[model samples]
Target: MSNSMKVSFCCKDCKRKMFDYYAGILNLYIKCNRCKRVLTLKKIDEKYVAERMINGKLFV
Candidate 1:
């Protein structure tokens, strides 16, 4: 199995909620699916990262 990082996207201009995608935190950037904006995933929370790296289910 491959390990991937978790990420969320937000718009730069509108600050609107955008996307959540498989992305590595070590990487400098990720693209927003909704707004098509480029953003740094580092701005997102660590809890999301913890959840992403875990087991088959992220929720109960």
Candidate 2:
């Protein structure tokens, strides 16, 4: 079986890198260490991953 979690947008803004988990596996919110931009992930059947940005652009 598989599982998923609805994470809060603000929760990811932690001071340090924290681990995000789903279905007994570990995943992370790919935020920039310098800019602290919370990288968003598009769920594609667990095998593929990508960043969610507006018009191929990202903000600080």
Candidate 3:
């Protein structure tokens, strides 16, 4: 059997729940369906951090 975990995060601009991902994913780049903004997810220090991409730059 394989082990997996659920990872959920919210959009920085909209404050809405974006999606639920599996723990196996360490990094991801996605667009917020509600606000239509680009977002990136990264794992740091055993935690998940969400950042927004704006004007070709990343904002935390």
Candidate 4:
């Protein structure tokens, strides 16, 4: 019964959450707190309720 969707982000190398909130504004230039790895997030739809990982090698 939630109107807002929750999109999660994780570290590709460590598989840990990048932020505390499940959903929030995405910043392309991000550093994973757990792994200390830099990540670039894509602009995905807000309706998606799943985690999307950026590998820096995929073609959108």
Off by over 4 Å in 3: 1-7, 21-25, 43-45, 48-60
Q: List the pairs of residues colliding in candidate 1.
A: none
Positional deviation of 1 in candidate 2, in angstroms? 28
Candidate 4 segments exceeding 4 Å error: 1-3, 20-27, 42-60
Tens-digit lDDT track for model 2 on 1-60?
235443222223443433333333233456656556666545432222114323322232
Model 2 ranges off by over 4 Å: 1-28, 44-60
Indicate the residue-level lDDT of 60 in model 2: 20
Report the C-alpha lDDT of model 3 over 1-60, residue by residue, as the tens digit: 023434456676887777754434457688987889997657532233223333322333
Q: After superposition, how far is residue 28 of candidate 3 from its true place, in Å?
A: 0.8
- Give TM-scores for every candidate, taking all chains together and pairing residue i with residue i: 0.29, 0.25, 0.48, 0.46
Worst 10 residues of 3 by lDDT: 45-54
User: To one decimal, what is the Cα RMSD in angstroms of model 4 from the true structure?
Assistant: 6.7
Model 3: lDDT equals 0.53
lDDT of 1 by residue, 1-46 (tens): 2346444444656556555546344445756565576766445345
Tell me the whole-model lDDT of each prediction, alpha carbons only.
0.49, 0.37, 0.53, 0.49
Please give, for residues 15-41, the per-residue lDDT of candidate 4 as tens digits: 776643344444467886766888766
Candidate 4 has a TM-score of 0.46
Off by over 4 Å in 1: 1-4, 23-60
Best by TM-score: 3
